[model samples]
Target: MSKWAYSTDGFDRIVHRIDGVETVTYAIGQGEPLVYFHGGGTFHGFEWVRPLAGEFRVFCPYHPNFGESGDAELGGMGDYVAHYEMLFPALGLDTFHLCGASMGGHMAARYAAANPLDVEKLALVSPAGLKSDRASIPDFSKVAPQDIPAMFVADPAWVAPFWPADPSPEWAALRARESAAAFASREDLSLTDRALREGLKGFDRPTLLLWGENDRIVPLGYVPEWEAVLPHAELEIIPGGSHLLLDEFPAAVEALRSFLKG
Candidate 1:
């Protein structure tokens, strides 16, 4: 088991070894645990659900090879499931709320489907599991850098904040590396194809599905698809959010908070 050095960000960060993968977890608050699983590409999990931290004890674990989480070349999604299965019990959590966004949301749904007794509630935000009308997912690596910001947010203004003010060689190199790693391994990591056909049928839980009205990635049309399977689930759309609803829509945090509270 490898140890990851979490920056001294004053957050309750801990490292756990499970299924030979060392996961970096950032935990906050002190009530019932609410696991906040972020998207596949990002570095920080705290940023994904910072606003919800006050309402629930949040446990955000960085998946292997992303962010500060070490890489162990996981075979598939089941590796993640095995790790979390051991993790929750090890942390003395027999039951908790599981919330995830994008790829994380897909993982959360799978986790709930596999361990319904352990998850009290589930929230999937702009989730990516269901196979779309298209046979294959668009390759992110093939998309030009200029297209990334547009694909991610409704407003182009949001793009400025993500890019560097001074494009130094080191910064550019690092960004390139991160982007390559993210896009390259997606075929091996994505749950889109199999998740919907096989995984959707068994997803019966108190599920909340959140969508961005302007989400270009998943497209709002997929809402009905989710509703068909998760008939008991409640759905909400945050306006002006593209694929990155949590960051693009300031209102998403409040909307989710209210939904969870209800």
Candidate 2:
């Protein structure tokens, strides 16, 4: 039996194929669909948008090879777009909101561009397409597990509590295995970092760029470039929040609501 846990949001776990790969998605809520793409690694999609389910009908799908989804024939931004293109129409979503975090932001932007006429709004949270000026992408395999928090957040103190106070031997072993799978997919990260540079300049749809002011992973300087790309787009930089601002700062969630609702 699949150990994947379902949600109380009344979402049903459904599977559909795209290019011979089986993808899993949680379909629930009501009204216009909000298709949320997950960040890099093994995170399930609904966990990414659980907080916003009450506001919009959320469609959170796992990318092939992530979570319960199977591997794709190929892995790349184009492959992801093709998969979503099929998945979207299958759900009967003619027009809907789109939001993504980290690598998912890259995929979301690519998908929106491919289907410009279909997306109602776009939201990117600490997106990953733009390369950092000074910080190179860290290799998880090389870094000490203890150093992981610093790479992803500004304050390690805030996140340490989330880990088990005294993790059992079994718990630690499982976590290591989970981390390995996440690192295995590192190559799938979108390489078209410069594609959104000029293309987003003329994007007329309502767009929001939410950044963590203290984000050390992606840096805070990219805000200017993002503003340049979508001059009319709104930006909300959460003070003291790190790369995982949406999870780190509850107020940031309210900001997202205001931006998307408006």
Q: How many residue pairs clash in each candidate?
A: 0, 0
Across 1-262, the per-residue lDDT of candidate 1 in tens digits comes to: 2121113254687888766677788887766678877775553225546666677888877777666666666545566666688878766678888888887877787788778888878888988766545323356679986776677678777555454345456445546655554454354333544655466576666788888887877777767767776888988888777778876676887777776677
Tell me the deviation in Å of residue 59 in model 1: 0.9
lDDT (Cα atoms) of all candidates against the true structure: 0.69, 0.69
Q: Which digits, one per residue and each the tens of the lDDT, describe model 2 over residues 164-252? A: 44656654554565455444444522356566764465677898898887776667776775676678888988888777676667777
Off by over 4 Å in 1: 1-10, 43-45, 134-137, 165-197, 200-202
Q: In candidate 1, which residue pairs clash?
A: none
lDDT for 183 in candidate 1 is 52
Candidate 2 local Cα displacement, residue 221, angstroms: 2.0
